[model samples]
Structure formats: C-alpha cells, structure tokens
Target: MTLLEVSDLRAGYGDLQILNGIDLSVNDGEYVTIIGPNGAGKSTLMDSIFGLTDHKGGTVSYDGEDITGLDTEECIRRGMNYVPQDDSIFPTLSVMENLKMGAYTESELSDEKLQDIYSRFPILEERTAQVAETMSGGQRQMLAIGRALISEPDLLILDEPSSGLAPHLVDELFDKIDEINADGTAILIVEQNAEEILNRADRGYLLTEGKMQREEGAEAMLADEEIRQEFLAG
Candidate 1:
C-alpha cells in the first residue's frame, strides 16, 4: 500500500521556486531516503509534502486521499509526523513534557505508547525530568525522535537527523532509525549523509537541482559506478 505519494510537486518559499516537478512515494512500512548535495532542494521537497512550503502545483496523496495543500495540523491528524532539522524539541521543556506534547492530539494518551518510546531510547527514560536544552546534542536528537514516536505515526518524516552528531553517534542514530522502521513505521528522510543513509534505506532517490535524477534499490545505488563517483566518492 502506498502510504504517501507526491506527483509533479513544485514548491518553495514565496516567490522563490525550489522544487521542480518532484515525484516520490513511500509505501507502507518502507524505508525511503532522498540524497542530494546542498541546495538541491531535498529539504524543500519534504516541507512541501508536509505543507510547510508554497504549493505551486502537484498532488500529495496520503493514504489514498488528496492532501495537496493540507496544513501541518491536519497532516498530523492523518498520522503523519515531521521532525525538522532544527528546533524539533521545546528547549525549555523536560524530556517527558516534550513527549507529552507529541501526544496532545491523541484522544487518550496511552502509557503503553509512552513506554515504547522510552524503551526505544533508554536515555530518554533516564532523563525524563531533564531539561531538553541541557542534554548533549546526540541525547537531544534522541529526545526529539522519542517525542515523535509517542504518537505512533504512520509515517515519520525526518530531515538530516544525523547532521551535527559525532561520527560514532551517527551509527547509533541510524541504528535507532532502523529499529523504528523494523517495528513497522514508514520513514521518509532527507539526509546529507549520503553513503550512510543510502546504505541502510530499502530504496533511495537521488535528487539534483530540484529534480529526481535516479531511483534504485539502496545497495544498487551504492554499487553504481556513476553514482559512487558523482555523489558517494571521497
């Protein structure tokens, strides 16, 4: 089942077009990554789907319904959650408080659900009362992810999740993401860590200059000589 679909998507900030007829999709429980260099409009594509950009043209379908220009709140009601690269957590809030906010839309906040998130990131459990801003960068990222997971979203959209983490922490972050996908949540990520993310994703798309340049199985993209040299090579 196709969980999310974007067709001929053209979006950007007001009066400045960034994405040009982009097409992408994430099926139920699939792990999909978009890799591109800086200024390729990868992040714009994500914002467009999440309804944070100016929608010039295109159809964004979620769960078989058209959500082309739906607001972020409505998108969340439809079981889609987005964690932007910056300011993803409330700096002044405690770890538990941030997570509780994630479940604000729920009719009944389930303890079991909270437990699952804590289990996924034990550090969050340990620092439930710790102020979000006081934690290390990696721990803050974990808190952000744990908060997003509280709602049990069908699709979790992440932008550059490993951006500022230490090299060792990058692997740990990816491992947690893998665990999330394994537990049946679909992921749509735009990552700068090309080799790292593409190596783990089930499928990947190469976006360049606001357009999709290639789509292939994750391992295949890594193996392609052209892709390796042009995008993955040192």
Candidate 2:
C-alpha cells in the first residue's frame, strides 16, 4: 500500500514556480530518494508536501487521507514528519531537550522513548546534556535525525541529510538511514549527491527543472552511462 502520494504538485515562492506538476509516491516501508541539480526544486517539493509552501494545485495524501492545505501541526499529527534542508535543530537547547521536543504534541512523553533513540544514536547519549550548537557538523545531523525519530513517525522525510559531511561521514549517515528503514519507518530523502544517494537508495528519481527525468533502481541509475553523464558524471 502507498503510504504517501503527491500528485501534480505545483509550488514556489512569490510568483515563480519551482515545482511544476511533480508527482511522487512512496510505498509502505520503502526507501526512496529524489536527486537533482541545485535548482531542481527538490527542497521545494519537500516543503510543499509538508505544507511549508503555497500549493497552487495538488493533492497530498498520507495513508489515503488528503492532507492538502493542512497546517504543519496537522501534517505531523497525521503521522508524517519532515526534516528540512537546514536549521532542523534548536541551537541553544541541550541534546536531550531537543529530542523531547519532537513529541510535544503527545499527551504523555516517555523517557523510555528517549532511551530508545539514544540507543540508536549513542553519540547523542554521550552528549545529552550538551547544547546542540556545541556539536560537530555530523553530530548535529545525527541529533536532528534522532529528534525526528523520537516522534516515531510513520513516514520520515529527510532533506539533504548528508549535506556538509565528509565522505566517510556521508557513508556512515547513509548506513544509519538504511538502518532506520530496516526498522520499518519508510524514508523519503531529497539529496543532491547523486552518486552517494543512488548507491544506497532502493529506488531513485532524477528531477530536473521541476520535472522527473527518470526513475529506476539506484544501482541501475549509477550504472547508466547517460545518467552518470547527466547527474553523476561530475
């Protein structure tokens, strides 16, 4: 069954359209990724789906319910979580405080949930009392992801989760993403690093100029000479 569906999504800032008739669907427990050039409207698509942008026209359905035009809170309440491309964490808050914030809507927040997340990210456990601003780049990203997981969302959207990381750290982050998916939370990641993301994604979509140029297995796309030339040949 499909967990999320976005059909003909058109959106942008002011009068300029960034996402033009974009369509994407993520199946239950599937790991899907969308990659494109810098201005490919990749992040815009994510923001639109999460109700952060003006949806000129489209339908966003989560678990067969139309969440179109729903407020950000409504989106989260519906078991959907979105992590933006940047500023995803509270800089002044301690690591533990940040994780607890993800479940603010819950009537009874559980420390057990925090422990579960800390187990997944041990670095976070060691730095629980430290301010988020004091952490290293990779550690901050880990905290951001850990915080999102605290909500136990049915679908998690990670925007450029590997951005700004060293090559080895990117590999480690992708490993964690795979681990999260393995534990059964469907992942929809938007990334610009075609080569790295394609290597790990179960399926990949190539978005160009607000349109889907191609869709195929991650490995297959990596193997294609034309795709390599167009997106990954750099």
If scored against the real structure, what TM-score would every candidate get?
A: 0.97, 0.96
Indicate which candidate wins on lDDT.
1
What would the per-residue lDDT of candidate 1 be over residues 1-234, giving only the tens digit for each residue? 999999999999999999999889999999999987889998888889989999999899999999998998899999899988966899999988898988888775588988888889999989999999999889998988888887788999999998888898989999999999999999999887889898889999999999999989999999998888888864
Residues 50-145, model 2: lDDT tens digits: 888887887989999999879988888888788887658999999988988888878655979988888888999999899999998889999999
The number of clashing residue pairs in model 2 is 0
Q: Model 2 off-target regions past 4 Å?
A: none
Angstrom error at residue 45, model 2: 0.4
Query: What does the lDDT come to for candidate 2?
Result: 0.87
Candidate lDDT scores, in order, read: 0.91, 0.87
User: RMSD of model 2, in Å?
Assistant: 1.2
